[model samples]
Target: MLLKLNPEHLLLIRTHAASTYPEECCGIILGYLANESKTVVEVIPTENAWSGETLEDNKRRRYAIAPEIMLKIQKEARDRSLHIIGIYHSHPDNPAIPSESDRIQAWQEYSYIIVSVPNGKAGELKSWHLDGDRQFQEEEIEIA
Candidate 1:
């Protein structure tokens, strides 16, 4: 599948990644699916709501959208005739690859975008989708 996004949307995600360096940045992508492509219409950045017991388990390695925030976004998307086509997140100082935890929590219908931020600089961006076996398959990213 293909993931299409405007350059402005790309910039917004990159900027958010850089701003939240050392901690992963996360957001929702609102859009529509047509044929075999997903076209992004809105990019909504959110706080990494992950809270762990120790400082070691922090945003640096994890991220989450609060249930309330997700519900609100879902309602807004429905009103605007858009679906949550995908989700995007940053991997600080790491490659743009999904971790095991990512797979465990992902839904089959949404594309997953990961941006690599090495030393506060946003680098490669990649898209993925879960296969029937629940394994991640890389998707093509088209910037317009």
Candidate 2:
């Protein structure tokens, strides 16, 4: 599927990734459907709630979005006539590839954009979607 994200949204996602270096940052992409293409219009940034017991490893490789916050975002989007089109997260010092945890947590029909942040800087970024077999398939991202 082709996921066309707005240039502004792209910038926001990158900025969020760069700022939240070391710890993974995640958020939702809100947009509307036009024929077969999903047009991204907004980005909703959320906190990484995977707090570790010790400071050394708190959310180093994991990110969890609060259900309450998600529900609230959904409701707000509904009110604005927008829908949740996808999700985005940064992989600090890692490649822009979805991990086992990402696949396990992903739902069907939603794009998952993984941003690679190496050395606290934004690196490669890509998008993916789950196929019928529930395997991740990279989606084409059009930064327009």
Cα deviation in Å at residue 109, candidate 1? 0.4
Estimate the overall C-alpha local distance difference test score of candidate 2: 0.90
For 26-120, candidate 1 gives per-residue lDDT tens digits of: 99999999999999999999999999767767899888999999999999999999999989999999999999988998999999999999999
- Give the TM-scores of the predictions, in the order they appear: 0.97, 0.93
Worst 10 residues of 2 by lDDT: 51-60
Residue 32 alpha-carbon offset, candidate 2, angstroms: 1.0
Report clash pairs, candidate 2: none
Top candidate, metric TM-score = 1
In terms of lDDT, model 1 sits at 0.95
lDDT of 2 by residue, 9-32 (tens): 878998999999988999999999
The alpha-carbon lDDT assigned to residue 97 of candidate 1 equals 97
lDDT of each: 0.95, 0.90
Q: Tell how far residue 133 is off in model 1, in angstroms.
A: 0.3
TM-score of 2: 0.93
RMSD of 2: 1.8
